[model samples]
Target chain A: MAKEKTSALHENKGVSQPKDTNTRAIKNIRTKRNTKLNTKALVASILKSDTVALSRAITLIESNHPSHIKQANAIIKACLPYANQSIRIGVTGVPGVGKSTFIEAFGKYLTSKGKRVAVLAIDPSSSLSKGSILGDKTRMEALVKDEHAFIRPSSSGDSLGGVARKTRESIILCEAAGFDVIIIETVGVGQSETTVHSMVDFFLLLKLAGAGDELQGIKRGIMEMADAVVINKADGDTLKHAQLAKVEFNKALQLYPIKASRWKPKVMLCSALQNEGIDSVWKLISDYIAITSKNHYFEKKRQEQNKFWLIQTIETQLKSHFFNRPDIKKELEQQLELIKANETTPFAAADYLLNL
Target chain B: MAKEKTSALHENKGVSQPKDTNTRAIKNIRTKRNTKLNTKALVASILKSDTVALSRAITLIESNHPSHIKQANAIIKACLPYANQSIRIGVTGVPGVGKSTFIEAFGKYLTSKGKRVAVLAIDPSSSLSKGSILGDKTRMEALVKDEHAFIRPSSSGDSLGGVARKTRESIILCEAAGFDVIIIETVGVGQSETTVHSMVDFFLLLKLAGAGDELQGIKRGIMEMADAVVINKADGDTLKHAQLAKVEFNKALQLYPIKASRWKPKVMLCSALQNEGIDSVWKLISDYIAITSKNHYFEKKRQEQNKFWLIQTIETQLKSHFFNRPDIKKELEQQLELIKANETTPFAAADYLLNL
Candidate 1:
């Protein structure tokens, strides 16, 4: 399978056929080194909140080599006892919303208060660009320099489902590493926000004050999932607009149905640049945790999210396995075209492909 | 599978064991007879607007008999040439919103205009009740008695996913049967409305004049999917409230981003009992069709729907097949317990089960 991917890579560079020499050699070295890592030692180090071991363990989870499966499973199982001790927060906003700056401010405040924070991103689109918002050191310099904060960009070169699975597993490792707070960052452009929302304890959506695209962000289906909506860059000239935006958002949210959690989603104003109102944001999260925990919704939500990811992971794997079949791939395009042309019904097409 | 389901049904009576006698006898006769149904004749009759043949064909699509697969595929293939000729509309509302009355009035109006209209419901909850809104003669008396209209309740004994597939296939059959307008009805609760929206060209949401559950409908993710919102029961004392609702909904919709079709969703007041504003509703549909068809959105939407259903059906089947395994089922409960106890991560548990 690795060789096939390698060949496909070469073909994309105008090579009609793959020369498996260099790719095979590099892949063999990586596989050997990955398999040689001691799982017990890694788990022990991770339990001590060792960042190096945590990175290695996450690498094992992201590895596609067949040999890494048992090792990855062993490490995760060993770390499972220490997991789920942290709050998982999902933060998202569109580009130009100062998401990285807000995250940096948020992380700095948590670390200053003697908290360990781990930040992970789930950006499937990063595979194409080789660049990520959190990956940029200049953007989150304060968090990057903070000893108690660990910021990891998205794992590139994988489908969103694959990245989601890896990120979810990484959360377990982060929790086991004694990180009291875990923030999952996502670009609020597409379906990734929903995926992140399902895996987190609280979902926060960032919006720009006085932006015309406020409704556009809501149209993407992120607003309803939000636990809080923060209007960023609320310093200096944007202060008035930010306050008005907060009021407008508060009114807009009332039009939505009451959430099952029975917790009212708050709209807040924040300026990451000035580091203003960051404490209020933290207070909101703390209040939510206190109230929901008292009502038993906090624990209930975690269990539900666990079950959701379990089913979601299995379904994603099943689909990929089916579509990866050589015969099915050979026939899929033709069947899709037939369906588009209305020459065959989608059911008939699916039946044909399944039977094939 | 049919035999298994039948035996399970009998076992539910506390018989403790299955006697294959009556179940097998009934199943064998039905399977053999259904397998022998002439596909060409069925298509010929359906193309000539025979509701009886259309109902029989829908039964084929809904059947669990293994022998019916090829016959069902043949019928759908034969009918494909005549499908996609009708305008598909999805209508939904919460219970007690007078959905059936509105649909009945809407269907009657279309049929009275010399158009053949087909009404199908996609209510999975109706399976347990053995009665459906569309099945009520008193509610839809006019449409039930109209010669130009064909009304069918939902197929029973299936999950929502299964029911959706059947409903989608039924739409094709109805379109092929010379129905100029096809209305797919769904309860305005849960995920069924999303399913209906994906398969239809236009989505209509029905709301009552003074219901406090207006936001409740939006919370279910139905409001955003609506191409039009109809404030039903706009007569007498409710007229003012209905007009107010129309204005409110129109304002609410303006906060949403422009739809991909670029067609602005409209809000209108109607009295199904008084049979007023029905023509205006029809005019809206006609105008929408004319504009979207001119811009080629109608064709583009159908093709996208075909592709969506194909992928959706395949994914649902894959999940069911995997979870249906007895061993997987047994392990699933244990794993879920472990997950709830925080003894295992969802990804790790999924890996363990998938490897099993």
Candidate 2:
């Protein structure tokens, strides 16, 4: 039995030799061919507004894939002219402000008006889990079924600001796909909200009817940037509270110097769940665009937003490069330990690390 | 007289004699020697804990004179070992939160305990006017009379953060001069508060009673970093409101994850005008330090702060360098104009500038 098994093993080894070599060649060929094909298809499909293909293109951009970046840039350049044609609106509020419901209701209204609306929810939660809920579509069942309405949740796995960048780029793709309005929905109010605000043409801040304490927690600088403040969940028991909040917000807005747009930021009440006051919010936004565009403030604002993104992008990249250097990293750790031991000052440590 | 002056001018020009050159050279040498002696004496006096000398040292640091920086660095190094010994406390609140009054009361309390205290006030408004009020000492009449107390105002010019860096470095000098506690007072809540907080061992956020809106405007992240939250003016009609604020803050703090120190943040009510609750605030800070130090969290926090500073410094310098570049500046202006004209997108414009 041993002799027979040995003969069989030897025979198998001899037979596998040529087959292994042939298989290895075929596998390499297949991989190379698949990569090339994927790239071509991604570019073409993204141009055609295929959601899956656009997602893949964004993934390529986010992953720092060298080839993907080159192709992404090419696709962007091709789609650039079609971009910046849509009105980009940024929506943000604290957690539990019914952001998803509002977007769903608002998107439905726009689609009903025969306008294509694209809802791009920039999820800060995406950074922790490489998966985004992309639940806006599921929640906005009415809007999801509309052929003219598109819903894309944030692609997870990046900084909040980085996610905003991808979403901003995706906005361009959406615009090229012929969407008339692009709404960027952020998960919560904070730095991410500011980031989204910096990217969009119109910023809408959603708030709940609460005692003025919540208002105090909102950064005045952010409030100053809002084009409109909507008190959401203004229905039933919340109606009186919402009205009070609207009045309080109006007073707070007055403290801020008038914006360059010459439009007093309007405070309005809305109920996303009941689908009440959605049309009024849209009308107010339309009026804002008309007034500001007529005064040329709209164009000026777009230009400012562009300049901000430009500087922000460069600064982010420069910071990443500085932090990524191996020697700098080691020296930084050592210096930090020294600082921890109180052996050296933070200023001196900074100087040493920077010089290093 | 004109003829005499003309004759002297002619004589000086015509004289190629060594005597004339020697006299001129002697004058130049005299002035240089005088300058050197003055600077050395100034630095020596500053090291001796003389307020006038300290003022001179700060001036030298702020000046553009090439030798001034070297002299300043030498003095700072001499003072370094004595630094980080003091419990550096940073106090910040909105304007009219009685920041000065609170510091005055707090400074007196520390002095009463036989502790030497130094107050450094960072006034962001001073940057534009090139003058700082430096009113902490004046406000704390009792503390000012105490030989163990010192007060220094922020220097004008540069960003608030830059002023903070200088003030932080100055604290070392003050501590070296034997101050046991250093209080950095900031007007209004802003990035300036964050800057001061980073340098200090304890951060005290001052809030007014019934300032719910103001409280809400304060970002949770910043609030999470505080060692203690003090509701100031907790006297008369404001007393109840202050107590209520304390409860609200305690609730708000629970939302944040456990801080690095593992010390539960304390919220206290204080009437700075009455000098009531000042000692409690100080006690809370001391308790925080003691507990955190025993657990070795104090050292860990300082290390994290140092790391943050290093990255911040590099970012600042890089930003300055990028903006200061002649070519980049030119391109930025051109791009701004193009963006204004809607001829290019901001992201593309940035990419172009960065590549250039």
Candidate 3:
């Protein structure tokens, strides 16, 4: 078995380490001088565009060890001043929607345009799915070999917040390492897409033309969040259906109010298998960047995202602290039962439990 | 102005009291036994179908007074056994889509069917506006007079969670008072609709026939949250447009994935002013209840809502505690500045502020 097999389900995988490591990670890092020195070396290496050092820093960020996480925060802080120079795009789709192939083609096209691209994944399912992103990295065989493109597999975790936080910090490391474009790929499971959407400048949804696509495409308001929807596999017999989907999505997109960015979302066709329409996807994103930059929405959104993550971080930690307690676990079940029996209100139950 | 003016923003009408009353309300309620006697009396009156008692109980729940909140929790606990007997329906739309009239007609219609109804509002805007729900009660004058109907204006609070918690607790008091149906009305603002949606069984979106309604109706993913969309003002000049809108909405609703309840959302046309198609709206809800109940989704959803509220209460309180700290408020500003200047990551800033 491959070394990545550890993150997979031994029985079924997703039970990765950490009954209570999220806040523990933050707590262990409290203004340690030793952490800053090691972080300095990591930061120096990353600023020199050494992907090896970037990967190592991210490993520290993903580690369950308290000391590693301590150094990780320091590394992130040191990398911060050299970051924020890349365009972060989030790509998402349901399984079998060809997300990996689509990104591989898109990343290759950007690299051809002299842009150094870094691809990262935020798949919460990967923990249970036998190193899914590592598998994807190998699938992007051609792009992986390109010096201008770097692909890192997602960190395995059961917590979407923990996974997302790791990926978010990784973007900084990638940026400081001179990656001009960062593509954050996530599978269409749970709230992963929304998590990615919040962390990215552009959110692109890849869709197959048919095969119950219309039924699931609009689930959870994913359609509303799309800055652009690219109908992938728009080659051969599927080409006609893909065009129809574009028209349908175009009409559907107009029903939404103008986004705060005041930039209209567009739909395009692609065939990553045929490597067709990849450049148009890049063109669409470039146009989005141009318009949003001109309107100042780009910078404003990034600032708001910063504030969102700050609060988000604290909230996630708060929940972890409250929930990871052994006492609260038993008390919560009792409260839930009291709720089901209508013997206690959820508010009242929560008050009791929180106080307890 | 009415007595409700006290809740209105003196500056413009929506800034009701509570510099810090949410968690404070809960903290003051801990393990107090003296509260039970007053609550026992209140619960007795409510079970006897006394609207005045029900209103008073809700007032206690809405009060920022520590003793009032303690007594309120007892009242809710006493009322719990009699609650869960009502079908909660959330009605929402942008202002001027005739929600007040629609609910008035709908409430009156249900009363005519020999169903006791309680109408409650959850307008977070009431804190800024001059007694909006109080004004709405007047618009619902006929229903207000119906012995079979009870109306309580929304509690005033800028915190949607606080206002929502008050309304949720009020539902128990209403149910204990023998109301068979509860209508939760909210104005489209911020996340009020979504807040209302989380607490209801049937989420209805009211839409005007035309006038840029399509653009704003779907804003913030509200359309996806609806279990049904009713086209209002379908009488006289607007009737044709309303019919057209019904068709369009029907098409749009079909595009969404089937709800977890496995129920397909319906679109209907209504003219509350003319009382046209009011019975059909009831029929639609009846059909929904029959199907969801048969599938066990109705009870399952209610149970899930119980758990959701339990967690929501804790999460809201957690955020309130963190953000309300004077130190956190100042520190957060500095941290955000650090983030914008790229001197630190949001996660790093969050850790620092949380520690401080």
Candidate 4:
């Protein structure tokens, strides 16, 4: 595997047994001497499935420094040829559904099956925590110790769109790093889930069996986006409730029309703590990927997602440019006040502003 | 009632009455006669609840002739001060759901209770029909003759956003004309329902008891916008099905989180043909309005809707401006191809285009 070569290269770094070792690869002298890191060398190592090089490249992508922009784009362009090979899955649930534990167990299960798994998160409100609140080594201890598993926290402090874009780019790097399966986890509180949903091939919504109370904290319109709903923590006293919730959710899902993909969303019950049903969840995903791939919906959806992201990126940038203009900003405030006072219609105000 | 004056004015026209009558009002000079139809006179008459002036002004608003633009804006400006006084309810249902018959019966019921009613529609695909397929005069035979009821088909031959904007402006005209209840009707398919939902104070989704087949043909994410879902055609043998559907929908709704209105959406069974449960549907809207108004959510939602429209209009216009540019259009096509080939990331392409 590509990863084994990366590991061998790292181990033979300074005390090289062969003369070709130093000449065969770019030296790590740049890293040790605090000089500019070689972008080509990083990309080469990342393509070889070097975890350290991949992580450093992602940091470059996330950096705000203008000088890093060119190098980051270069690294991404180099990795693009090797990206999009992995199946991307997005998992979302409100806080307290034991997402970290679920991901840990799921990641460990996949690693045991010899599948390289990469877990990334999208948390819009985690600027204070910097990255994944659940990504602490203590939270995912087993996965943290696994050589076949990689878990990265959410990028902090930027806009949700910014973080989402970075996470999307990072997915490309991880895939180039030879991760076979990529999982994106987002909190269901705000708009992050929708962002993650747009970038992934399949979306899984996690839920608890709190009956009606479980739906309270979740935002509206998200349930319809789920490709599957898994009732988590279904053990002991909650087992019956989880079973009932699964039945109820299936019934509710039947009320929705089949999506264009012709894939009917399923509802399942699981106990991540006990490691029960995790295999079934993985099987469901594998089955979904197999069917979608056979039917060509998988590639079609990825192309569509790519197009959507292009249009969305342009729109976001255009909007930011318009709103950030000092002149428009002042005029917009006045227009908002006039609208609040009912002195003018929004259409008329928009007309005036656009003309201005 | 203000409608009485409108009725009297039509009756008094062309009569050899007192000499002061001529001086009391401005003549309709723009009627190709030697006299000028005073704009102020039209505004005054509309404010006096003159249905003739109201209908003419709405026609002006709907006209695409460049000459009509100034007059339409003037009319909307005149009506703005008196608008926002009525409760705007949006009604939507798929074909065969009996929306027209329901609206006729509901309008008649309201007029019988001494409340003037105005019904309008939003049909994006109706450019082919040039208006509401349901608003055919023969279909709404009773409403066509009812003095206290005003029914207008959709504004035809425009985009959904254009039609929705016109209809929203028409709502203001109706309110200013003393129609105390305004209802905007739309087909459930496509994007019309969402446009109507955004403009109205309350949204009611009409459905037929199709077991589960009813959800087909309707787009996803619309059901979540409904303030109430009414099972229509609940008469004769279908009554049992409608009742069952009501219960099923109620259960399905429970799976969704409560809306921001903090009001639970109700499912009611109504037979527009038999006029059964029609009053109860009205009661639901009244209760909704009463509760939302008391809690100030009514006004808050209206303000938010206003703000939303303002930003949406600006964004839509900005997008059209960007996409319509020949330079940008050429670049966009090339960028789309590159994205399809995975030769470039969306963010990078967007940056390239925006700088252009």
DockQ winner among the candidates? 3
Per-residue lDDT, model 1, residue A17, is 77
The list of candidate 3 runs beyond 4 A from truth reads: A1-47, A93-115, A134-138, A205-298, B1-44, B92-114, B134-138, B188-190, B201-296
Count clashing residue pairs in model 3.
Answer: 11
Residue B137 C-alpha lDDT in model 2:
37
Q: What is the lDDT of residue A109 in candidate 3?
A: 87
CAPRI tier for the interface of model 1 = medium
lDDT per residue (tens digit) for residues A1-356 in model 4: 45454644365336646655575345556443432447878988998888888888889889988757777888888888889999899999878888988988999999999999999888987875645665566788989889998888877888988998899999999999999999999887678888998999999999999855454554667878999999999999999889888878888788777887788899998999999999999999988998899989999999888888888999999999998989899998899888778688899999999988
- B32-115, model 3: which lDDT tens digit per residue? 444665677778999999888888888899999998987888788888898998999999988889998999899999999999
Error of 1 at B26 (Å): 16
Q: Per-residue lDDT tens digits of candidate 4, residues B233-307?
A: 888888888888787788778877788899999999888889889999999999999999999999999999998
DockQ each: 0.54, 0.39, 0.55, 0.47
When only the first chain is scored, the TM-scores of the models are 0.85, 0.82, 0.84, 0.85
Provide the lDDT at B200 for model 1.
92
lDDT tens digits, residue span A230-329, model 3:
9999999989998888888888899777899998999999999999999888888999999999999999999999999999899888888888899999
Can you write out model 1's per-residue Cα lDDT over B273-305, one digit (the tens) per residue? 899998999999899999999999999998888
Q: After superposition, how far is residue B249 of candidate 4 from its true place, in Å?
A: 6.1
Error of 3 at B145 (Å): 3.2
Task: List the candidates' TM-scores in order.
Answer: 0.79, 0.73, 0.77, 0.77
> How far out, in Å, is residue A66 in model 3?
2.5
* Candidate 2 lDDT (Cα, 0 to 1): 0.78
Candidate 3 accuracy as lDDT = 0.86
Error of 3 at A83 (Å): 2.8
Candidate 2 residue runs with Cα over 4 Å from true position: A1-63, A92-105, A135-145, A205-260, A264-277, A341-343, B1-59, B91-113, B135-147, B189-191, B203-301, B340-344
lDDT of 1 by residue, A26-95 (tens): 9988866765558878998999888999998898889998667678878888888888899999999888
